[model samples]
Target: AASSGDLNWSLNPTYTGCSITGAVGSQVLSCSLGTVAGNTTLPVIHVQSATTPADCGVVSNQATVATTNGTGGDSDTANVTILCPGLAIEKTADAASVTVGSTIGFTVTVSNNGAGTATGVDMSDPLPTGPGITWSIDNAHTSGPLSCVITAGTLHCTGSLDAGETQVVHITSPTQWTGSGETEVNSCLGGTDNTGVYDNTAQVSASNVTGTPNASAQEAVLCPDLHVTKVADDASVDAGSPIGFVITASNTGDAPATGAFVNDPLPTGVDWSIPEGGSTGPLTCQISAGTLTCSGTLAPGASQVVHITAPTTFADCGVYNNTATFTATDSPQTPNDSDSTSVLCAALTLSKTADAASVNAGSQIGFTVTASNAAGGSVGTARGVVINDPLPSGTGIDWSIASGPGNCSITGAVGSEVLHCTAVDLAPGASESVHVVSATGNTSCATYPNAASLTADNAPGLSANASTQVVNCVIVSPPSPPKQHHPAVLPNTGGPDGRLLGLATGLMVTGGALVLGDRRRRRRS
Candidate 1:
């Protein structure tokens, strides 16, 4: 019998199987064992019967046993070693170009290609044009020949590189833009690319600047100028009448002449007199103002003429002289000029009023007057220029009111003795006057109006006014007298023209920045 989990030892004689060997008293035995963990017993044991009754090495009591080595589990172990690359230089930028005196940028990279990591990498470079380039540690851009080291393009670069880690070095050159040549920048110590760095220079050029380019720059222009001349009409004339003369002014300069005035100075014997308001600027004759004042602009080589009548009574008129003075000034450019005509004085002879004149006291009568010039100007060849008939002595007029209407008497201003006389004359050799009708205000009087003179010649006893009362007159005589013009000098040493010449001669934001890498020392594997 057996229980599931229990062990029991038992002996059975019928199931015996055994073997044993011993001495003479030895015997054979057969035995069997059961499941050791659960059953501990012998199935049977057979032994040979021998002389010794107790010879069966008798298995005293059946027993069970087991054995195991004193060991727990399993264990194993392994070990190994490795290496990284060393630090080496690298160049991101090898070359560049710029206009002369200009600037450019580049980069240099350093890598830790070694067995171990490296820290605090540095970089730098050299320059030819020292002032044109700057070196940066933690590469930074700077003017003048400079060198520097960088970490991430920064000057304040503080970086570390493990084995195979890389840092970049930057380079920048700001030039002064001067030359037209080229040069190369070489890698000195920390060349990341191990190549060349260079900047090529070019020449400078310029173009014309347009309109008011510079504030103080003046506007440029060309000026114009002119010329003038004067001449008499007749070859000769009587002693007491009128003379003829002409003035011609022209533009002769290359440029246009504007704001100009023509001045003609009158001669002593032959007066270049002007009308009441006609005479302007003290006998410095003006075409418009009669005394030589004119308003106009003249083109190059252009010409104009002024006709004049010279009333004369020959007290002294052999040769009368005069001249045309043309002055001009223009705008934009500086300008100055003055011109004049030639000189001449003519002769004259006077015829008196038959020595003693006779006329009705109440009835108007007349007298004769004449004039002449050696330069060929004439007036009254016949009758010796009678001082117009009936009106001579009877008329009354006022010379005071030169232009407007006013009370009139035969009396002329300036108490001119010649004007006082009913008739008067002024010629070179002959000077005389005549008294006609003695009537007071019975008829109009005076050969000329209250008129002053345009150009008057002198006559003895005849007031300058008496013979010169034709200044404001429009109608003119032919064969003008030659004016004893003092041919206007170029006014270098004398005259107001020179004084004016003396007066005119005088005039005398912020952006960002990029930096470069660390200074890395290269090492071998």
Candidate 2:
């Protein structure tokens, strides 16, 4: 046979009886055709591809056979083609923009593009680098691979792919990105059938491919944080005493802070002062309607401190408290700090009085003594209260404590005894009274003076005096008259003289009668 078409025909090695006469490209075969009554067929020759290269695409071949050196000969033609493997790759990203400290995802697909199966397939991708961009492959998302590794910012994967088969890979962005408006580029390539391609944009390589495929992504950055606190120098203070306070503000984020201020409302019993000094910036402070405001600025990781003085002037005893707040621009929430203090002192009073101004001797006189504390609740309770009252000496009065507190006792004689009363705890605004009864002594008719004194712990002594008057009276009797006894024997001597004169006259008359009787008897005879 002779060469006929553009296709080159060769002799097969299995055909032992036939051989080529000229060069292989000349395609002239020398073989024996035995003589026969019917038809005879010779050994076969192979047809080679001319239009298609190896492993590129399908190549068609046509062969013709004809009878030579004979009339009315027959001819026949036949066609065939060749086939090879192909590969392709593609890449995609989940996001184009993200914040700092955020993660981004990427996916790569490797596929077999030819009709035949692809073996020993390999895929690789290089890490993306920019002003603030970093990347790494995610092992959890890589699938259908014999072996995979990430070393020195590069990912390598090996596996096999069938006809029209595909494989995928996933990667994540870096943990930090500080650059603003920076772009990140990534790509992937695959190789199979001992062939590969290199990509410029993705910076990756793939087998059985021509050009590289890649993807790009970008991100932005933003960050801000602020805090404040307050404290007082003293937790408790006396009335009208000065108190000091310190307030602090800080910015701990990666961004600057503006329009930051501290607000504090001075309580009713406090008098506030101007702000002293601060750090990181100049501080301006103002007070209006009992509210104090201090303003300043702070950079990243910067702080400010402010000092203030306040005086307390509360009328009664109690507790006082104050709170301060902090605010800033671009901050939605506000924070507060607070402190408290107490004010106190001690006050006491004493008084004495009597039930009557004057009293008779040996009569009872009543006296009342009172002790009180004038401090309110803010100061606290008074402790260790005592009272002493001694009866006066030589006052002609006997005195004793009749009714008093259970802790009181009397010592010495009634006329000069000392009465003592003690109280363990005397609460503020509370009072105690001591009653004493005194009786006058039966001594002389004169005026008697009396006095008593009261004394206590941590207090001054007080005294009171009183006097009583006594009366003395005198008695007298009259004298008797003298008696007379001579009237009883007065007239006996004058009556005896008259009786002697009468006896003499009677004797003369008797003598004259006897003379007349003798003359008459002589005439009758």
Report lDDT per candidate.
Answer: 0.36, 0.55
Clashes of each: 129, 8
lDDT of 2 by residue, 1-525 (tens): 444333355555546545555543355555554443455545455523342224244333333433455564545644343333466666665554333344655677777776655555667666554333456667788776436666776766676677677777777754342222333221111112211112212322334444444443332222335677777767765444666666777777554556778788876756677645433344566777888787866666777776677764434345657788876663433778788766554355666666666554456666777777676555534456677777554455556778877887777885567777865456667777778776654442345455655553334455666555543211112322433323232243234233322111112233112211111101110
- lDDT by residue for model 1 over 1-525, one digit each (tens)? 111111122333444333333333222233443334433543434222211112112223222222343242232322212232344543433233332233345454555555444444333233223323453433242221212333442342234556655555445545331222254332221122321224222111111101111001111112343455666655555555566556666665544556666666555555554445422221133433235444476666666666666566545345555565676544212222322222223233433232123322223333333333233333322222223221222234222212211211234333241222222333334433333222223233224322112123332222122221111112222433443324344434345332322222211101111222232222211
- Candidate 2 — which residues are off by over 4 angstroms? 1-319, 322-334, 337-347, 374-380, 413-416, 444-525
Per-model TM-score, in order, reads: 0.23, 0.35
lDDT of 1: 0.36
Alpha-carbon deviation at 407 in model 1, angstroms: 45
lDDT of 1 at 110: 50
Q: Provide the RMSD of all predictions against the true structure, rounded to 1 decimal.
A: 45.6, 25.4
* Stretch of 10 with least lDDT, candidate 2: 516-525
Model 2: how far is 175 from its true place, Å? Answer: 15
